[model samples]
Target: MQSPPATAPVAAPPERGTSPRRAAPRLVGWLAAAWLGPLLAYALGVAGVLPVVVLGLTAALLRGGRTLLDRLVLAGALLLGAACAAGLLFSAWPWGLHPVPVAGTALTVLLGVAAATGRRPRLPRPVPADLLPVAAALVAAGALAWPYLRAGDLAGRLAYAMTGEDNSRHLATVEGIRAVGGYLFADPSAAARIAPEGMVWYPQGFHLTAALLDGFLRSSTAPAGPASTLDHYLGWSLGAWGLLVLAVTWAANRLAGPRLDLPRAAALTGALTAACLGSELARFVVYGYPGESLGLAATVLLVALACRPVARTGTQLAVVGALCVAVGFAYLMFLPVVAVLVLAWLVRDRRRLRRRPAVLAVVALLTAVLAPLPAVAGLLRTDQVDNVATGGGVFPRYDAFLALAGLVAAGLFAGGLRLPVWRRYAGALAAALAFAGGFLVYFRALGTDPRYYYGKTLHLLLAVLLVGAGAVTLLLPAPGRAAQSRPRAARPHDRAAESRPRAARPHDRAAESRPRAARLRWRTPRPARALAAAAVVLACAGLAGLPRGTGIFAQPFDGRTMTWAAAWWSGTQARPGPAELAVRALAQAPAEAGVVTVVVSDRRREGYLATLFVATLQGTHGASGPAVYRLPLSEPARSAALVERVPGRIRFVAADPAAAGIVEALLAAHPDLAGRVTLQRLR
Candidate 1:
């Protein structure tokens, strides 16, 4: 095994001014590598290949060499780009119906064509040191997931630890897509109450991929019954978190590179991973925001890509655009945050922008044209905008603390100004701050609570700020430089040194001749620099300790947790509930039963539970529009009338003691209703 160098070597830059004929081969190589990695991995029964492929292909496209960290950062842009592109295309006929199979065949064909016409992609060789960050990320993921995994029973393990109500809605939407074999627009009826009338568009990237995985898993496992909604939700949400942690650690290491040795790289990765896992952002999972989780992962990757210079090739740029599209589909709100980063990137790389004036003009025009697109067609309906706009603060007390922290981070970022690389950190910090400021001002202008929606940006801001502060490690002298600065006594075996140039360069002589006091301007005092490095290390340690200190880590364990709110529905092992049994029987219901309607007596309390499971288990289990309709069963006649009005041959009615008698009486009153209805009595 070869020892890794002080700085990981990178691939040779793509040749400048290459002819189209030559570029074509590399472009093909890029696509083939990108597509084939995920496609093959999925075929091989690998779970979580989406992020891995995005990360790998990004490395291949950016022509990021053997340095592991570079690919992680660049992966952000590629993940969104590639997923969006593929997802949109998958929404097309035939492909949407059989996404996994179609994706495999299409990617295989593309790979074959590229192999026949283009040069093989010269992928970076992984080093032993590369595994360090990956291991750290895995540890962080495992730690975060410990609460759910700690359950003694299978049902408990599959239960989503987070209490967020959004999980039920999201799962229902995913179930709708899976049932329809395409985007919700393809068959709005399948979406049940999840898709309200006139809500024209919803980003389906996250749901689409989850649905595909659901299909893939069902086909592969040959399960005796319908797959668990809780299982799918848990896997997807936690998987996104894992990818985010991996990206954070990799980007943090890359941002503090050149002087970082193998041990330092490992330490930095571990510390950053811990801080990221401990940060307030981890609560997103607690809130059951799976779409936001995936989108945020892509957002971090995009930021990392922007922290560096622009992509070298148009193919790489196209890949980035695809990622943007994917991000929009995954979570529309994050796109504005992405746009802020792109603007900062453009400003930072003005020279590149200047050279490509046409590209710059096109970007500006697109920005102007596309900025208002969300308002026109986003998930938030016109009526809902005020509800969102008028929302109260998420955490009012933390405002002053966060603001102070931001200023301190900005000050620390400024401390690294001597190095040209500091500009990268500056660009990232500026983008984050600009995003925060812009959102805060907008909310204030609307005269609403500032922190409600604005709170979403906290994780992104904290991640960037910590990474920027971590760059303070650069203030410490490089190992080789430190060695050179030390006074060395001449030795008899120093022949190799004398063979080298003995003449001191003018700048070197001037530096040596300067008084120590005068040299203070150019050179930081060693003790002061060491102290600064120590302080940064302590600050990061403090951040990593937050979850434990604040007891945030124990939240999932302590909270009113559920698996799509089905834990209460499923009941304990000693007392299994009717959900699974009911779904099984419903699957075998006669055609005369027609389209099934699930009526849960308590719609406001447990309606979503019925909706989510019915959609997952039976596929498109809603009555006409909503998955399950709630009626005031307390009024027997009115409730019976409403149930009779449900346009379906078969109805699965779940009602408690109070409502069961009414349902039974309704059945008795109408022999036709008794034939059509299957009532499950709740305890």
Candidate 2:
């Protein structure tokens, strides 16, 4: 295979010429490739034509004598086409019986290995100076927007976890493990029966971390409940925010070309796309569902690490192990995807592997061993084996539109089809196939009313596709040189003497050199600026009406609200001591005299939990027993009625005494209780 020489800057088309538009046929062809490529591949696989299609594409490309990059791209496109064809062709066949495509994939891997044998060029390493700020902005966006979107039912979930409901379950398992003093796996059947909803299917690693954190916090502060409410927010924030940063940064780096520019815009757009795709996953976290978030986060990290071209052996092993653990914990379907990625990586760098095959082998072994731990535990302890088998019949419909849109978005953003690297092509192809297969599996697992499954899977696939596309688009093209006022096709003899090649022969000489900074400064004149403005306006209009007429801030209490709430909560109770003590004092009060009415401005459950923790710590019977009326100041008559009915039973009402009518009403309604009420300012 003849590799293409290092890319030389191409002269820009003359300014007077009209810009070339994609031919209508070419547009249709590309659209068809996007939409029907998988389907055609699946059909061929079913008809036993996969081999023919692969060989034909490969032969055709080879015959064309295209550059090595083109050949590599063609190879990947063929493999992807084959996988999709096989999927469709064997749609009715069981996964096990579909052998042709599997064999074809194996053959593709072998070819990839053979092709990578020669000397490979090294790309520049990405610098933190270029990456960190973009990453930070993406993380900030997630943090800022998370709180508002996390309110209502979502807040209740976090509140439940914070109060220790979810953590308590995990802790019980952990305590059991500690009691046994080894890796004492719980009974899967019993575990499943009592396992917190949404977590029953997940592995233990992620939950184990949460449990450990809860234990430490409890030991230190002895919060009233089994879990800390803060744990929910912290867990969600960390997992979601972390994934967003990693994914968006990866995408931005891919899009920003070797030098990062104002990558914030691309990062933000990519983040939004990812958020939309993973919205359900986000909701799962807010509802105190850590299992899904944990699994999803693990998957994201695993994919990110796998995407790295050069990694330490140890890092690769660690990533493999983590991925295995994540798959074991989250979903079994992930195993095949992980397998394909690792195999592809190995194929791409077989020479490196020959030097240290043991590392890869060890990673494979650990992955196999550790990944099944949770599944084994389930098998031994319960009927999960049968459950998994029975559940196999459930299949969700794959949203063709979303998948197409995601592919287009990914293509546009990452320039996946445009990249010259074989590894990049392989990675993109693998991702697309994995997504399609995973969706098929997911659909199968949904059984009935697969629409919900479609919704969930559509978001996930779109995120993956868009991120992939965006990264590809950014990295493929090198920066353009600054435009000069020179006339087109000027005679080489008229050019400056220094601009001429020093070498005697054309092939032996390098192109005219320009500083990287100078090259980056090149801007297309007036027409380009006008086009960019038009594009921006169109983009803004499109965003304003995205998801079928929804506004940009259409979702209720989106990221903005969540961020504000989280910030406010963080600021008000920077330390939990005062709030903890206050709740304890209230909890110590007598119950029959009625409850301790703690009036707080925020209606979130975290606030109530904080109040309850303080009351419980103070040895207040009302805090633990009953009659604990933790009313929001927003509710007036209810607060008044509780005080009126309880009278002397109301020992203390915690409130911001300086507040307006609500405080005045409380003071007037229960003057005796008001004297006993402690005015504690969070600040």
Candidate 3:
């Protein structure tokens, strides 16, 4: 709950309002600021609900005279919680879960009933000064996010969101959601029911986004294909990630305690964004881990919300409960993350918080812990795998950026030891880093083949360290001598002195006659100097360690991480290659509610073609439920005896020409498939 410093320096009043000639840049600036909200909505796929939720929060925020940090916390938590909860609820309703409906109805009733009981909404106080810096940051964040898409596939290219590491599953899951299309989360829930781990029950807000976006594209005149997916991503998801970075930056700096001014807060954001790409988590994006991205954003948001003054009212409890369900439904790990935040919050202010809002705080904590019970139960039902501890590589290969980032962050922290940040947040910062280390140790101790566990900690550690550094750097000493204190001759009224006939004030003629540069040599203004340094820091913070090479920012998406992905746990197993895209001929062939036995004889890629076949079929419309049987193509791969044992009621065959001939010879020999089997040759 550390508050960011208030917008520190107010702008000096201008002599007059701007004229029309200078208005275009200001308009463009406002337009950029306007894009921030939609960027987050598109990223989370809450466009349908986000605007409404934003209106509600805005109304409440104005009534309460909320700070920009507080407003963002409220808006982010409220929107994410509502959208994800609705998704989970609709998806779960088919299984007879009343969580969403019950909660929604109860909340609606409470809103009305409590209207008469709660305090009347207040008229908001106008505070333009406080809002200006926040406005600038919003536009700045949008500006930073803008360039990433300019270099994307939007111009002309064929691709799916196949760039990220786990995007195969992530993108497939999104299509799977569409493939099982129904009322909102209901279809998504059905998907979850089929394969909770792979497709269904994970954090699905991003999927919901996909659903919303894809549904729109489906209805539009836009071309349909993988290239369309690229368009959607470039137009939306890419910018959304940028917005997420900005939102997290705001939350992190705000969490550092409220004295953070806009420039420093922005510095912290830049620093944090730079580290995000370099962190082990970058692997998730490189690998296409959709859930991890959403979960991480939620974690930052939950932490941000913990800073909101804890309240004990039916309405507060209801909202918190909704958010808990959303977090669990979106990504269950975040429940624990929020739980830790709750524990930390309670622990930090135990003496002070014990008095008034104790019961309410407990309610909030219990809500967070218990909200994900259904998901936890589902996870428990799955068989567990215990991996014996084997160590992982330190700093990881190809992540030299991580090493550079760590050095920079450490230096920043160390360099600022003389600053006040150490006095207030040194312990909290240490605790966060320690907690991150502890996570690594605990997981590495369990040695459960860490997919993303250790790296998540690195992300957290980097962000915390950057916030500490930014706070110190931004908290520069107050301007010296010449006085933000209004020194004599340079006062606002001093301009009026020119009209007075004070005999040219000694050397005024010489000063006026001097070269423009020479006359102003000693002016050395503090504001420009401070702001110029801050601007350079901001640029470096935003651009440093970003993904480099041909990408929009520094990070190139799919190609850079392919090397690491090849070594990933699932890289070798049933991993699809180019064959999936090559096998479109079969999609046009007749299919039934049965299994497809694929025999791919491309010796250059053996098991890889089979993997492609399975993933491609799973992605086929109305085939999400299909059972895939992989048959490696060889003389021995086809067995006439095995043809009779195929389990599907209606069988289909899809294979390369040689494999098709092999399958045809086998079927000719046995004739067991009868009319129930269909065979289509793949190109």
TM-score of each: 0.70, 0.46, 0.62
Which candidate comes out best when scored by TM-score?
A: 1
Worst 10 residues of 2 by lDDT: 489-498
Q: Which candidate model has the greater lDDT, 2 or 3?
A: 3
lDDT of 2 by residue, 1-683 (tens): 44322221121221222223533454445445533543454554442344445444453322111122222322332332233223222223343223333434444543443233221222122232334434443554454344433543423333333433343334333332222221223333333222332233335544443432333333221223422343443554455445444444443333323322233334334444434323333344333334444444445444544453322343345444655565565444345555666667667667756767777777667567666656675666566544433322322223533443554455444433343332354464456556655656655675543333334344344444444433433332332442222222221111112233444211101112545564446455646644554565355434433333333322323333232123223332132333443444343432332335443433334334544433332333222223234344244544455455444434433344432345456777657766544433332
Q: Which lDDT values do the candidates have, in the order given?
A: 0.52, 0.39, 0.43
Q: Please give the RMSD to the true structure for each candidate, in Å.
A: 8.7, 20.7, 12.9
By lDDT rank, best first, the candidates go 1, 3, 2
What TM-score should be assigned to candidate 2?
0.46
- lDDT over C-alpha atoms for residue 285 of model 1: 61
The TM-score, computed over Cα atoms with residue i paired to residue i, of candidate 1 is: 0.70
Assess the local accuracy of residue 525 in candidate 3 as a C-alpha lDDT between 0 and 100.
Answer: 66
Q: lDDT per residue, candidate 1, 351-387, as tens digits?
A: 7457656755664554344333433455344453554
Better of 2 and 3 by TM-score: 3
